[model samples]
Target: MAYSTTIRRRRRTRRIDRAGNPAAIGRWLLFVAGLVALMVVVGGITRLTESGLSIAYWKPVSGILPPLDAEAWQRTFAAYQATPEYRLVNRGMTLDEFKSIFWWEYVHRLLGRLIGLAYGFPLLVLWMRRRIPSGLKPRLLLIFLLGGAQGLLGWFMVKSGLVHEPQVSHYRLAAHLLLAILIFSLLLWTALDLLEPRHGSRQRRWRAMAMVLLLLVVVQIGLGALVAGLKAGYAFNTWPKMGEHWLPPELFALKPFWRNFFDNAIMVQFLHRLNAMLVAGWCLLIAVSTWRFEAPPRTIAAALALLLLIVGQIWLGIVTLVEGVPVAIAAAHQAGAVLVLALTLYFLHMNRRTAHHL
Candidate 1:
């Protein structure tokens, strides 16, 4: 009886330990999501302040720390001066002004590094301790690696503007933004998986719609990035009309047809506006579908919240564009986008859960 009691106690201890494992993983996921959110805001500042190309060099290992002395600062500034941005845009910028932009990009990189450590060290510890399932280790490590790759891709994006071009490649900018959003979506989705139990029922239709909305949001964001890359927002400067008409003249004036969508400011901005309308329409549809159907309350709530957010985001976009992409409004517009992405992710996961149960 004594031995049996000891065995039972040990088993209970193991059970408790097992129970806490998921919560720890959940906490880490939440931390990563928060960090990604900060990265997005900082990224917006980098772009709005035109600070992205200030660093001029990518030192993945050594660049984590900003310059400490005047000599180091001069070297960094000298590199920036060599870039086309400095020659064409900020021809006579002082070192002090250069420092302002340098710090923003530096901080952006630093946050990324910290996020890696915060994710990786804990992940390794958990895996070694058998707290993380064997199956999850590979997927989680891929996420960690993607975060690292994002930094490299960022450098690649910056390198484009440092040459003949006055600004970064819109294509690279779109890819970078898409990658970041994908990382955020993956983290949030994984967190949902860990937080919730196996599904008892499923809603396939809503799930499909949720995913479609997500893809539309991502595409819209990519288009928005292209608009930013080209500084296209400055051209439109109005809501519901593009310089007096709903559609601009000769969207394919740039030639090859697709180049207009990717390269032309007027066409790119026009597409962004159109994409926003499509996203808002999809959100409204999802909201109505979720409300009318007898699915999970979370799904319904997420859809409704997303609908409201979509409306506000559209308004913010108009204000930002009409107001000439002012820093505050532009930043808010970007923040609103991330929020909408989060809500869509939430609803999609909920839909997945509902479907699994069914």
Candidate 2:
């Protein structure tokens, strides 16, 4: 017992001795993860307000500044006036009205630009200082590249709405959202790996359950993107019953049937609802198993967080649906998904190691 206690003390001492650069980098990644979440919230607002296509053009550099004077404002408005959205829907929108929508998209894009700089500049300094873990260097580079691809994807999604139709493609919207979530997940997982990293593998309990939950959450979130893209929430205002019955009658409305899952508005909303039930059930099972088994401190905390957040998310989704998808409520619903995913990632990371010691 005396020798074992001394070894534990030495291990703690060594841990303290090893905490400088990687720790700072971990904290930095957390900060970046936060910015990503904020951007998701703002993106929700932008979509809810229909401000995504306000700028009418993607200017990587010169577009940073909004219109400064009446002439510039008119020119910008003229540009928007050329789009299908202006001609078909917002024909008589004034300059001040234009500015209101413009700011949301502007801030959204501006935030994206700022995030790029925030990540890239600090990363360069870290590389120069040799602060990054050797194994993590490639992962960080891939994340940066993915970030760039995300920017391109955002514009691509926006461009679809600029063409003949006044609405963006639901498929493209789902892709964009999924990619953003992916980036956020990677940023978070990487940060956790650095901050409270495990030294070696242990017997992970309920590992399969956690993986399934994570996958279900991702699919459910994507289904949500479909709901938002198709504006399906507006189609059905009653829940626990999607209009009149527990099952939507139009689940296979499209000819191919599979297309109904993606393109049909009513069908999309139904699948999203169905998927939510699976996610909730699976989460409850995980929570129970964690309570019944011997789980680590962090894992237990993560499970509780998931339970609370998942319950809140279900309630929020119902409220959002019944309230006719109001901007504030709908945006909160989207943010709720992010929170649930964050906890799920923590749970998965925690389950990978068998130690209950920490």
Candidate 1 lDDT over residue span 215-257, tens digit each: 9999888888898888999987987889888877867798788
Point out where model 2 deviates above 4 Å: 1-20, 199-203, 353-358
How does each model score on lDDT?
A: 0.83, 0.87
lDDT by residue (149-213, candidate 2, tens digit) is 99999999999999999899888999999999999998998888887765323535567788999
After superposition, candidate 1 runs with Cα above 4 Å error: 1-20, 199-201, 353-358
Per-residue lDDT of 216 in model 1: 94
Worst window of 10 by summed lDDT in candidate 1: 349-358
RMSD to truth, every model: 3.0, 5.0
